[model samples]
Target: MADYHSPTVIQPTIPSADMTALERLILGHIFDTEADGDGLYLFAEIGPSDSFELPVRDLRRAIAASADTESTVNAYISERIAALTDDDTHVEIDLSGMSWEFILQDIVRRSPTLDHVTAISAFTCTRMRPDGFGGMAVVITADAIRGKSTNDIVEDFLGDDAHDALYAGTHVLLRVREHAVKEQIAEAIGADPDLTSINPDAVTESDIRSACLDVVACSDLSEEQGAAEFRAAVAAIRAAERRDQAPG
Candidate 1:
């Protein structure tokens, strides 16, 4: 073997507060893995003197450097994505149910292996309703070439049989808001309080009167008043639907 010499490079000292613990850890990992004999040098001289320096040898360093500033973080993550292994994986912490477009856009902007992404999936609890509290979790795994479209990849993963297994036994709860009288009538008639698919055509005035009388008997409402109210409610609903169907 001939003589081997690593390149000589100057490492800049960065302030501690500017970088997060996770960012520093990622940088150190990348530096140890990818840096040549001469450690990477951070380019921070153009900004204010108080700005921190970050020399990245690998993805970790790049991530740390970007975490120091908001605008540069995207660039840093993009570079790191390029430097990451073909098998790089990512996890998204989403407790706010952000739109898929936003999530994927951010991921693509920061990831080098965007095309190689093989699988993406969500993991979350039923309590974290995507429609309500906007809580969700996402993870992505990629192949070596990073050659797939994010939308297609995410759709396929979601469509997979394995993905469905995760949501097994999870009951979705839907809230229905109605007048207290309507709810009582539904309960008395053995109809679901939340059911909105009742066909008015399939029912008659007699049905409404009967339901109302039952509700009144079961509750505090006077039977005569309840029957009158039920008739009025049915007429109102029918009128509204007719108005909706009529041309504006």
Candidate 2:
């Protein structure tokens, strides 16, 4: 189990062919790039099917014309990754229970032959206060942050050779966690509900209530308001069942 962080960026080596199609798709999206000026080029690649190649002269021109080139590029990558989706996708990786070092080490271990890896960076888990629903957020940065401002650093790394690959991989990892949480919640309730599943590793106070509601709705044991009383009753029954099975 890894300590849950808000977001952490990792640079995974190219994985073997054993990875799922979705994983391959993400990896393909990442490592796409083209040579540009002075040994600089657009570094992001989404998949084998998606990529961008910019000439050095063109890159310089674009940066010169924009007041915030790095900001622009970072925003582009963020938007692009957010838009990615697959039909009936359901998988998630939860970092809340895993340590950062272990997670990174696992990634590296999983792809021992990959050589393009450069750097992996991440932000510590930060508490975010939403108007009504507050939770912790993990921030991940895969490329080097070189500029003075965060925006500049983003841009510089977005321009790295591995930017796209890093973005796609990180995005996939996030989705994996989301799906895993949903799955756990569904299993807990013995019924699939409309709300997304709660990542057990990062379960919030709200998640507990949400799960309780689902359990009440699905259990065969009650029919009233399905309030705390019902929950306690059902929980007690479950506890007794477990206790009965203990290896005595």
lDDT of each: 0.40, 0.38
How displaced is residue 204 in candidate 2, in Å?
30
lDDT of 2 by residue, 66-164 (tens): 423233232333343444354423323222332333222333334435323333223332344332221222222232122143445556787885777
**Runs in model 2 lying further than 4 Å from the true structure:** 1-20, 30-42, 45-107, 114-116, 119-248
lDDT by residue for model 1 (151-248), tens: 55667887886757988854433223234445555565566545656643345434556666675466643576668678978999999999999997
Task: Give candidate 1's TM-score.
Answer: 0.16
TM-score for predicted model 2 compared with the true structure: 0.17
User: What would the TM-scores of all predictions be?
Assistant: 0.16, 0.17
